[model samples]
Target: MNIKQPDWEAIERAYRAGALSIRTIAERNGISDTAIRKKAKAAGWERDLSEQVRKEVRNKLVRGEVREDQCANPERDAEIIEEAAEEGATVVRSHRRDIRKATNLANLLMDDLLNTIQRREEIEDEIERETAGDESGFRRSSMLAAVALPSNAKTLFQLSSAMKNLQVLERTAFGLDEKEKSADADELSSLIDELSKDA
Candidate 1:
């Protein structure tokens, strides 16, 4: 009588590796998953460190936070690079939103400043018209003297300073300093390339 014995040792190794499902491993080895499970249970088989590391890397990749060392293969490296690019794009879009908001605020401030100046000019014109026939120029001088600072002058100054500061900050955030002409996109792309090379 001849018996075709199964290589239980190899089966156990594959089971502990945890890369393949029990069902798939069983099919490859020409056995039932139940049989493999029974043997694994009897032998006290548990997933090895590689399996644990793979799981951890998988979780981190999904969150776009996997380090290059954790996923050190071409396929996994591509996945991580793509994830990083997506994260970078999201950041860029957010920066764009900030830029738009800052620009809108500046536009509003400019509009208000123009309106305030126009109102001031109108007030001055009205005073001049009222005193047009004053041969002594006394009333015009007195009225002009009573005119103190414009009501929105302080606000206009503050807004102007704030807008200028905001523009500087925006430029800095994007690596757009006058000395550095390179764009943020280039930095982000190079970052992705470096990650891939490290992997």
Candidate 2:
């Protein structure tokens, strides 16, 4: 029967140095957990408990939150940087002033965009009101132009009312026409036809 023996020296050095997981070391050395643990014990190696505890504490620090010791506590920040150096990880700090400026600029741009949308809606509403008033006037004028029929004219009131409406609509059209660079002539022609229907 053959008994397997693990390389104790390598396992001891890795354990004392606070290296990656036992699984990672196992993969690197092409060995199993039982072999690594047995070898570590044989070499009198103890895990760097402080390094492990520090790792757990740092994991709770949410990414991008300004670290308390980044500038305020040099000792704490130095310790953090040293720990990171030992782990071969980079430490980066962001400029608070630059972040604040970016936040303000983003807020300003959002406000400007919202104001622009509101103004556009207001302009659209005004144009719609003008167009509706113009159309109503046109219809009134067409009905009025149809003229009188009999002494007991039933439709006389309706015709006169339509003509009066057209006169008012023609006035409203001028205001709406000036708002845009170009007016749709076809739409004006359609309004005229609608006005003349009763005539």
Candidate 3:
């Protein structure tokens, strides 16, 4: 069996240059990417300047000072700008979607808290009936009993703080909190007035 030594000097030069990806460099040197990564980490190699290079190129494109090499094709500039814009919009939409999901979860928690407080006795009775004595010990019923209700002042305070934090997140996600009259509210008020007139 014959073993060949890897060119460490060439590898170091390529790694420090930060032009080729680690995988590519490792493949060229006939080594694993993990081996190159370990060597790079041990040597404290500088990060790739690809992001910086792209930023500089983007700035130049925005200023209409693109180099001939950059715009090898006439439509490259437009494509790059369009791609960047789509990437930015995707990030924003993803952020908004996550915020919306968090807000929905918070709203559900609030509702659960309110329901448990208002109908504690009824809910407890339901649970008890569902879990009635069985010799076989087959009591399979849990209607949110696992969810601990805030009993003491400390727990209540914590819940309040969490709700307040959710409120702040909601405000930041969507603009400031507004108390606009909803159509449902107006319709309900109209129905009440009509019933009063009939009576």
Best by TM-score: 1
**CA lDDT scores, all candidates in order:** 0.58, 0.43, 0.53
Error of 1 at 8 (Å): 28
Clashing pairs in 3: none
Per-residue lDDT of candidate 3, residues 1-199 (tens digit)? 8799898867765554333456666887999989987987998755333232333333443443433354434354334433433333344345557667776876776676677677877776776776676454334333534433635334457667877886776574343563443233224324323433433
TM-score of each predicted structure versus truth: 0.38, 0.28, 0.36
Higher-TM-score candidate of 2 and 3: 3
59-169 per-residue lDDT for model 2 (tens digits): 433232324333334454444434533442221112223334454655565465445444654644555565575746665444333321332144434445554554454
Task: Name the best candidate (by lDDT).
Answer: 1
TM-score of candidate 2 against the unseen true structure: 0.28
Locate the minimum summed-lDDT window of 10 residues in model 2: 88-97
Q: How many clashes would you count in candidate 3? A: 0
RMSD to the hidden true structure, all candidates: 17.5, 29.5, 19.2
- lDDT, model 3, position 32: 93
lDDT of 1 by residue, 1-199 (tens): 9877778877765565444456656887888999998888888776432323343333443453434454435454444344434444454446557777987978887896677566776777888999999898988877755443654666678788888888876775454673523233234334434433433
